[model samples]
Target chain A: MSLCEKNIFKSIFDEWNQSIQRFIQARKIAAEDAADLTQECFVRLWKNCHKVSRDGASSYLFKLAQNISIDHFRKQQVRLKYTGQMASKSEKEDGQYLMEMQEFKERLEKAIDGMSEASRVVFVMHRMENYSYKEIANQLEIGIKAVEKRMHKALKYLSEQNILKKR
Target chain B: MSESEDILLSKWLQNKLSAEEKLMLEEQYDLESLALILERQKTLEIQTVSSDQLWDQLDSKLSHETKVDKNQSGSRRKLIWVALILLIGASLAFLLLAGSEKTIQSAKGEQVRHLMADGSIILIAPGSSITFNEKDWSNKREIQLEGQAFFDVEKGGSFVVESNQGVVKVLGTEFEIWESGKQMKVQCFEGSVSVGNLTGAEKILGVNDAIDLNNQRFSDVYNHGQLEATFKSGQMKYRAINVASLATELERFYNISVRLEKIDLNKSFTGILVLNDLEKAVEYLSKTMNWEYDLNEQNLIFSSN
Candidate 1:
């Protein structure tokens, strides 16, 4: 890549990649897979940087990352069919599994929405960017104790809501 | 789910757990299920990648692609661009059907530009929304809109944008479609677009062709379709639209409730709706329509002068 192109691409990546990762993770994609898709999203951004407008770039990156996760998730669903082939009839297990997944997702979304605004943003920063308690506190201009409290509260809320799947 | 257990789990997540503490948690949940839950927890709390490593990965991919396609990169670049978007769209559309409906909504005072996995681009205006089977997009290339949007569609298969009141079908074109409340307008800026109302009657619009629901006639809104365009400088431009129609649009644009009581229903105005300044909007509308408006806490109230 040219120096100019690299510079442009770097700035865009630096700005939106963390939020993109968070968005993917919010959809329940595994962290590693989200990272991979985040990279892919920026690579496409680099390839078509000229077409992207400054105001539109962030949303474009997010939508691209989201679409990648959806695609990746669908492929995983397809793979699961092979594993389920042996145990039960396709019709019965498929319907039940889909409903369970949907319900789980809805609950998780509700749990996040129920969190206080600061807690939710702090939680996203902690999870998406892996910020430490001190880092989140410093970034949000809050106390470290407050950060820890919010993080713990968010975790507890999700757990209590039974939003995360238990094996 | 005790406080102690929560602390331990949070510590383990922070990688502060020692060998023994890890084993203790493993013993508590058992190794397999514990591992499964921990693995799933990463989704809620993401694992961050160091920026340096991510940069290297991106650099390597860029170098590899450039080295391979240096000469014929123009056509190949186009192919990759189109393919990149198409792959994302086709896959997401698949999931939208199997998973749930995927809808794109834009809030007031914001515009979102979405590039489909196909090469088509959709520029959604504020206070507008659109829905389509994300899963069916690759195959069907159809979408439903609730506000106004300018679609720059790539030439290939027929793409369709449906709204509450009408449908727009096109083979490869650049056009703007507005569908809100009882107002629906489609303008073909480039190529040709076919529009069908709630009724089945259809009209194919060539370049510069515009058709409104209120007017059955198809006419020219722009001359020399080759001329480029830019957004309306934070002001929504309206030409000879009714007060009621203007009210609905202002409600969407400002994200504020507008009550047009005590005013002539048929009074029409042609002017600009300036964003960011309620005073300017009041000045413009009241002057143009000879109407008085009161800006309230939650709503804009209008009355006859």
Candidate 2:
């Protein structure tokens, strides 16, 4: 609640507002709707101003603008779809995500399980356990290039299987 | 694109591109190809988006709408490394330590709130990590800290946080510990905690107590009430901290690479940084110091004007 913090917030808002407005405009959101989205994003930033880092603010603002704009575009259809699909279910934030991942857990395992042995082991070490390529290569007594290749292979496998989409 | 270009694109997507390498990519590749690769890479991240309908409902109900035009959202990308955490977590469940010796980490721009088996809670900042033996939770309740964290401990026998240079012990208190590079910083908001180095040096800190490598202790360092929970609101407090130190902290939480030019490294500023926008934060820093900064693609470089 310090003036310094408030000043900091004001400065950040002034600096990024125009660009975010432009981004929202580019998305074809009406000026008023764009303004509303921009305002909502900034308001959310102010409310949760303490939880985020300084250098991450602008992108955060843009992300809010982008999502809000997207939702604005999809609102009518999305509302109908949601009410039709979810009217019977009690809304649970965590449950929604958990349920989304319900089938994904086994699918994720199957994707990994189907990888070539070398690629599978490398994938497990790098992706799951969070080991570095250097460490994984050193632990397995393979070259770093080999490790990268296997990881690339594993990723390619996942992409082919549609575990990780190729876009 | 050549194999090297493919690798370069991958590194660019991962944001592992060094300044020189990034410059090379921008110079050598067409925007179209880069966008194509980037568009493809974006699909690899399977992050969850917020429920617009639910949030709209909530927004309509409790409306203390801001007068000032403002917008903010959590950063869309994880940035440094791609992590489909739920997918990885579901697969890595067996890899977790069983009895004790557990390590908890937050990836860059990721905040992890971990509840210990005991009622104590550790909220780790991004690019920060912590490790503890869960078996000792009830007995001594010790944890080893690597970067920065806010600890809210239950009234237990004793809660301890061990850093590379020092250790903090408390019965029950709210405090923050940041161990950056070689320096250890401890700030206590409420109750009292005892902190000391491994060589047996120690001090007792009470409410509003602050200490860092530069200043051993200070009575009135911050102007905020209950400084420990301020981060929950989306702000970071830096007090008389040098530019290099501040830059390092920015890289940790903001997921940005910051480097100071030769002339700007020595300047120190005391300020609160609002993390509502990244570019604006850089602008604030540059404007405050009367310097110039350039954003070349992913890197934000600040230099003397």
Candidate 3:
């Protein structure tokens, strides 16, 4: 790439590559695989930079990373099928596994919705809301022990109900 | 199904269990409960919403953002619309098949623009429908239609248009087609075009040739046969058309409203006039007929006063 194109690519990569790296880490892809995938995403973005609008570039990069992840898994599935060596689960097992996953997701949402306002707020802040426990404790004006206790109670109640497992 | 085991499983699934508690649960809980907890955790990781629900939220945000006064609003509106569209597009990608073959229809006398994949544009007229492979559009710029539209196709590989009775194919072109209720007319105003009938037989139309279809018969019309050229040629008598008929003609021409006033029933005014502006068209008609007219909000009132 020319210097200008490289600069544009570098700027875009600099802005959104962190999210891709987070996605890699969140998905628990191996460190090497994560690096490879992140690099592949940048290369793809550089290749298609002309067509992608710069305004929603973050979303575009994320979507590209997502597609690459799907492709990676699909390739892994094919390889596993040929070699008879499954990494985590067979593809059919994964399908049933996904169905179960979706059921659990629905139940989890319901459970979260049913949580008491204070407990729900505390739990969401610490978990899905991505706030530190200390931050949540400070924001809610509650003691750290109280926040942790509520989260523990919330999870225990959810698990005991087995609402997700029943699905 | 032990109560203690369920409690431990829930804690583990919630990620609220401490390191020691997690190990204890994995060791003490049955395999099934452990599997259930893993499944629950995986499910909690994804964000899924129905496309309609997501679109509703996005549309609300967009409408709210665009509702500001029209001064500093132009660029803001565009930016918000682009953001809203991109966000909706990405989220929709996550829950891919939640919306399938969904078609939204416009009310009578409405014209709307649909932004499709591949950067192509389709402007659908009132009572028209454009259907395509929602999934396939990711790979191809192809649309199947039933009714009428003006396409400003993106410049790329061949853009195919398949209708009930025929098929139209072109790389990139700006053209209008009306295909409903005993009418199928493809007017190629720019670029090259190739159209085929349902019989797998096709004909390629050049710059000015239009295909006029009557049920099974499709005939090609050259420049002289089209009404657009006559209007452009400044032939007043040749351009003269029925007033009631002119409303429908002008509707598609200017893509706006035209209200006929109290004039002679059969008044056929003949002149080469620009139909770009409805206000201007009313002015020209009023001048030619020596009638008076006023632009009242959206309505153009014409009288002999």
Candidate 4:
């Protein structure tokens, strides 16, 4: 690559690398896996640099990250199936309470999965990644009210699922 | 729950609630359930990784790959040079046999009018260009356009104007095509034309019909009563167009950079923009939009007042 192309690629990497990783991590991927996926995303981006315009770089990177994370998740599921390993359940003194908690967790996950992508992303960014609403608004390039609205909608939808009420 | 209460609960989850708001929320909702849900959500938090360290790893990997690519390309350089020279020689010979392609370009703040061999006319907008093979014009009426242009095609075989955003094909029509960035606007003033985007989606527009496309998707479809392009009459007119779109036109007309600061770009503007005078155009826009602007050599910044 020429110095100019290298500079462009470096700038794009610097601008989007952390955001892409955070985006993947927010989807419940481990930090290490998110980093690897982020690296792969950038590699694909660099390979296809000629095809992507500078103006569309952010959306392209995000779309690439989303696909990479989804593929990684699918492969993980396949590996788990082959290994016959289930997710470790939480251990508690009261077996009945533990069973109820596990069921509630599953329902919560289901509720989150059923949310609109926009609302889910906002919710996960705030809840899992601990991003402030203002920070999320800036990162997503949306108004603060939009971020709040999505948060409200997500929480409201989850509350409607009655996961906590079961307890 | 009420909208305001939901917003308050959301704020509480972020630990951004004031003492009074917390009291209000505790009194209204089940605080125990909220706390339980928040505690369980902690299990979903992914482990945090150092961004700088990851970037370091990525940088090393990229540089290593680059080195490999460079070494491979170095060995193939001589062959590529030879192939390029041969290709250039062949192309030169071919150009000598078949006449060279012709290109017409309009400079900043200028419009160029060209009459084709088949009695068709094209008015190229400022800072725009079109290229075609004059030798094959009769057989293939195709021109590659960049930026904006108004075309009046004579009734004949299919006339095609290709742009980066979309392709306009017409049998006999007068139409204006404005292509810049990812947005392409096609307005058919007479006859009919079919506009096909890079995605293969196509729209046939009759007289006075117009369509605006963004990223190969239809954004706006409308109709106008204008007989021809307004720019052809020494003025540009827009009806309820986005301020950002208008800024793009200004940038092309004046060959300047337009930057918006703290301005709502979605705000629409409807008026005539005089193409000949930059000062008058800015004055009119500022007065109508109630905006303050700063102009510093080739750059114009518009900010909300």
Candidate 5:
């Protein structure tokens, strides 16, 4: 990490490093993957600490971590494809796993794309940027109450989408 | 309509709802809402970034810009809004976040005493909160709060309370900040507190001084008397006032029935009592005022009928 990046990470470390860790874990990402994603989140925050407007901080980091998780899953798929063919369980199990991953990614993408801009920003900031209502409000120049309303709407919309429907 | 459901939803969404709101929501709403909300949040999260592409781009760009540090530093300080992000992921911080070792909790009416790894203790008041990243203790001692909390921070290094209103920065001091509703009040009990608004205006509140915030401005000023009178009393103390104001407070405190028919509505009392004692307190008023009282299970009538 560069000095700027280190400082950014350090600052984020001071602010919400815990919150991001919780978010990734809540997503059920494994321990090692969670750590990598957390580190990656800081790196992203450090690198882009200046480019995007401050309002984008929470949403940006959240989006970064989410994207990292997807990448981890995608890499896992390649590994599974090569390794599973030989030492595999039943064909049904393999098919089921692939189907689940595809469904998970698809539902997630649709939800993000479908969310209202304000709601999406709120959700992303809360989830990825690890920002609270107060921080989001400060970043966006809105009231903390407003930040809260957007978050509620975003989560409500996401939940209504049935993205986490069990198989 | 259930407060519990609202709380569960807010918790699921990671928003700040009051404890009463949380309890009401959880008690009234179905748990399915909680599960569904969590699930959707997860799904939405998984779809946001694709990964490492931005990093590769930034890597080459940063390598080329050697003198960007000074430029970025000046700009970064401008976005001090980022300081308030500390309260997120309390559960995650405990379960997965790195380098936190202390469990700090502020109860519903009890201010929690927080001893940071850096030899600092924050006395976070009731209906208020604070959490530290125990994993990162050596490098940073950060705390985030919701509602009003006080800090008697021991000296060593920088400690900050990031609230919805603004940042209360402390090198080391004692202060109480009550941030509830539209107003944010910061009172300096000892030493000095640096209060900064997001618009980048900063004010140093000295011992026994306070600043009230409205429209993002440190606009109002008060001394220790006002701060102590308001917060120290815990509840608003009304002395022999009209029934209307007392009733309003009564409604909040005890949820009792207070009906004044054929009696002086503006009649006042003399003794001072807390809202918590509305029942007995009001009864005492009735006797003093020479009024006949009818009590029927949670409902009280004060009149000559």
Candidate 6:
């Protein structure tokens, strides 16, 4: 509302919008929703700008983004009920291969979804978002060793799913 | 694998493995499959939007909100002075009209759940509203619905749901009703329901039966498997449905518009679409149907590949 508040909000937005968006996207959220959620985080900050100091803005915004991601995760869990049986259709020339690939992809997705939140976040941040170990550590405020541990756990879990072995 | 091997695999994936470490890891475990998995994972990368563009959109939204806030505060100040003078009269009016019609509405991407006095539950879908006379509900069970809702009625008296398209009446049943513009769809998941259109054509739908009314004409009753409605389950399950209808479902579920270009609307599709993630849902649909799509903001364009 005030020029000072708007400036602070803009500075925070400029500093952290991409980070917040990437954080949510790394949590397996779609890009558009992640962008919307990132905007929501900033809007929330702007509304509470009177209470939040500029120095605390980073943590406040990231916390809001984390909470939003968690909420989205819970909602996705409720919505995702994988129960549809693939219909037996007349196969085209490459239908069998395509179906096999689709099945593997679904399995991998389910495997990732089944991982613990910590490990999944770390894994996706490194693998999908291309965040380096030290960068992930700095972003998550965890040690590099911790990031490596979670990434290892995620890889182990996926390997145990035998997703690649099945192929 | 041992802890060391697991760490090695993790490092290998991160490109943190040294030449000797990579050789040791490859000797113990196959690296080719890991490469394949990583390659597949690349295909799942999420598309990102430009931060500057999003900021522009948010800036406009914030300015509009600020304007609204200022107007609301100004109005509130004026209302406060007026309220002090009319306090007694307002209290009297409030008491006299305590139990009028109650309306429950859901905003975009929001679902509202309402519980009736009779222990029945109604789940209103996004961008929908329901109005009912709560005080008189015991005598006559009825509600007017605008968009879409899932009704889980307890067995007691006859329950009726009315819309501009038609009316649905049941003794006790679980059903979903969706009405918009000139189209309406009613699906009975539990007990039987009687449906009648504005043209006076009536039909009784049994469990798992569905009927569609377009322009006040009812389609022949069709039977589907026992599955929870989309509003209740957050998943859209289609069974050999046409592409046009699927597009409509996508629009309703995500609050987005889907446009078809040089494509056949009648091509049938059967699959389950999860409604939680719009990108994944669109990706699944396009991949399975062999269509290409472009999404911009809330508009999705699909074309034949």
Best model number under lDDT: 6
- In terms of lDDT, the poorest run of 10 residues in model 1 chain B is B224-233
Candidate 6, position A26, lDDT:
57
C-alpha RMSD in Å of predicted model 3 compared with the true structure: 28.1
- lDDT value, candidate 5, whole model: 0.57
For model 3, what is the alpha-carbon lDDT of residue B100? Answer: 58
Task: Tell me the lDDT of model 3 at A152.
Answer: 55
Instruction: Kindly report, for each predicted structure in the order presented, the TM-score of its chain A compared with the true chain A.
Output: 0.45, 0.41, 0.42, 0.55, 0.44, 0.61
TM-score, ranked from best to worst: 1, 6, 2, 4, 3, 5
B7-106 in candidate 4: lDDT tens per residue? 7767877688899888987776676776777677666433445667877887787787778778878889787888899999988877786967999999
DockQ, each predicted model: 0.11, 0.02, 0.03, 0.17, 0.05, 0.17
Of the candidates shown, which would achieve the greatest TM-score relative to the real structure?
1
- In model 1, what is the error at residue A59, expressed in angstroms? 22
Residue B84's lDDT in candidate 3: 96
- Candidate 4: where are CA atoms >4 Å away? A1-167, B1-99, B238-245, B255-272, B295-299
Candidate 6: tens digits of C-alpha lDDT, residues B128-228:
89999887789889999998898878788889999989999984478999876677889997778999998788999987799888789888999754345
lDDT of 5 by residue, B47-147 (tens): 21222443444345555554576676777755455543544555556567456445455454244455566655555554456766777766675677776
Q: lDDT tens digits, residues B14-120, model 2?
A: 57789988898678655354344324332222111233432453245224443222222233355222457765774566356445487999887667778778656
Q: Report the C-alpha lDDT of model 1 over A49-111, residue by residue, as the tens digit.
A: 778876667767766764465324411100001112222356446977656544544555566
What clash count goes with each model? 5, 22, 1, 0, 19, 0
Clashing pairs in 4: none
* lDDT, residue B22, model 2: 81
Q: Quick one: RMSD of model 1?
A: 21.6
Candidate 4: residue B183 Cα off by (Å)? 1.3
> Against the unseen true structure, what C-alpha lDDT does each candidate score?
0.65, 0.61, 0.55, 0.75, 0.57, 0.76
Estimate TM-scores for all models: 0.45, 0.43, 0.34, 0.41, 0.32, 0.44
- Fnat per candidate, as a fraction, reads 0.20, 0.00, 0.03, 0.29, 0.03, 0.35
TM-score of 4: 0.41
